[model samples]
Target: MAENPAYPVGLRLTGRKVVVLGGGQVAQRRLPALIAAGADILLVSPEATPSVEAMADAGEITWHRRPYAEGDLADAWYALIATGDTEANTRASAEAERHRVWCVRSDDADAATAWTPATGHSEGVTVAVLTTEARGRDPRHTAAIRDAVVEGLRDGTLVAPHHRTRTPGVALVGGGPGDPDLITVRGRRLLAEADVVIADRLGPRDLLAELPPHVEVIDAAKIPYGRFMAQEAINNALIEHAKQGKSVVRLKGGDPYVFGRGMEELNALAEAGIPCTVVPGISSSISVPGAAGIPVTHRGVAHEFTVVSGHVAPDDERSLVDWASLAKLTGTLVILMGVDKIGKIAETLVAHGKPADTPVALVQEGTTAAQRRVDATLATVGETVRTQEVKPPAVIVIGEVVGVGPRTSA
Candidate 1:
């Protein structure tokens, strides 16, 4: 038996070969991360879910329209056997060993060479929560902590602690995904109470429609894809608003702490002797795709999921994404920038090991009235987008979950 290697922090697969021997939802769950990490994928199974077929057609992965066999793993580097049948997985594992490949048998976690973890990624940060012999999470407490964060978003109390006593309140809220309706009730109420609202260009505008006409609305005058108001200037504005006792709300999309830069703003307030609270909003990273009819988790598709940002800084050579390692994982990949870098991202995924034909969906303004979807594979996605025009404020989803959306004509 080969010893399991230690997992590195901030892992992603940029280039690698990973074979998933199953066609059901579970196997589908493993495709996204592998594609995101840049792994070439070969899916082997006699039967495949609609999602799997989509991936195959998109060229995100190569499909073997046959059952698992001893010869399938002839050149496999890392293998995942996720079929419902334990016997099949075991047989596949034996075949992988014969070819000197490391294997992870999903049916038997301990028997596999590696274990997948529940992950939350934002900005360039990734947090992996694992429950293993060496490290574990408290299921009971975990839910409570997660809820508290959600509650903060549901109510402006978390983002604007001083609002409780002041005449007007100030809240830095995250709106979550692209759906205007998904904003927490508290965030909604706070938006109503705002005498003045300073929103990011990306924040969904529909959510702001409910505001009173008398309440002044400012765009905060940010430059598109460019720096507008410096953080220092923005912090000063919040403090300025609070000193006047005007209810001020700083709105952001998705959970603020996750990558919305909520902490920096909060710190600025604190240093200025102003009190602030943070409310967590539903992260679009998971919710947008979910509302698009995709489940980040399914019985067989995946046991764990990871979230990452599509936008990386130009100068940062150190990618928070460990593409080589992520290529070996099994999870859904949700990217925030669906159009800007879809082609490069698809190419990177394919070069790594993800099948060039992996299924990919570009959901523009997901959960909104103007929502549009383009279904294609990693190989054809670039070409497909060229033929079809997709605007910004979109989410790019690649995985079995995408199969849940309306069918795309080949």
Candidate 2:
């Protein structure tokens, strides 16, 4: 057991030389962080994972295709010994010690002078957990703590917030179903950094309360009926706010592109010559059904699934849905924003050759505490919707795939 304790400090390795003596699993795990820190990486190994090879091909790092040798860390600021060969790792660490460079041994941390802490990053804060227990420094234990802090920051529990240079741009972030935890890690980070948040009614509304006082929260579906506003006005609001040198977040439910008008916003911002980024969220069309114990596509049950907007009635001339064709697909049919038109939609599907007995599931406000799943057949779904008073934003799954999985928590 290595009884000697080590001091913890953040290394400023940006543009500094770092030597990595392996390109396998351990190297793959540690390389991205070093590359992200802008280190001048020199990778020594005979073979590497496809991802590391791709990185090398992209000129992100310099690859030395050979075994590790003494004096490898002569001019390196930091060194990592990750080879499978014990002798090679020992030699590399000894050379790092000789050259006054702290070496991290992947196979045996006790033999190395430095230990890599379990690390995570969120909202510009990097949480690193290190175990001081020399006899039993379980990396898993340290990583659990790191994950908790990072998750808390992500879900707005750990509110260590900051402003990052006031980037005057738009971030089209998909808020994911109704669950605050379902949002993507990058989306959550950008949400924390937003100066203004333009939110939709169907979006994860719970997260809005977590925003700081300085952040301007605009409701697109409130008293003003902002979602009904001319899209030009919406575009102008985004442009105007960004022009003021504030980071703007246009938060929408599920994927911004899945009938959320995200591309229009992207185009408007692009035409205005403003920088923008799109962080995708989990689409409710799939997640909601799953949350309700309905698999949109089950192996040996449903090979294909089609997602359609039910907001427009089938009789409407503007509606382009091929109800006749949709009726023909033996696979699953996922309808979003279709609760109001479910009766009409189901009538059309059944009339157009879809079986009246096809299993149907309507999941309302899925992935939330208020989530409710109602099971019915195509022939009875319309009646069930009326009886249950199921409203908009519910995911209607039509197919045998709905019953493929043992019913979740009803």
Best model number under lDDT? 2
Which pairs, if any, clash in model 2?
A: none
lDDT (CA) per prediction: 0.70, 0.88
lDDT of candidate 2 over 304-375, digit per residue (tens)? 999999989999998999999999999999999899999899999999999999988999889999988898
What is the per-residue lDDT of model 1 for residues 1-410, given as tens digits with 9 covering 90 to 100?
A: 33444464443445566788988977777777777777788898888999889989999999988878778787667788888888888888777777877776767765665665554433233445544342333545544654555554444334433335546546888877767778878677677667778787767687677666777776755513234456666777778877787778888877887767788888887787766656578887777666667677677776766666667621238557655554455667777754766777777776678777666777777776776777888788877777887778777777766675554321
For model 1, the run of ten residues with the poorest summed lDDT = 154-163
lDDT of 1 at 121: 39
**lDDT, candidate 1, residue 347?**
75
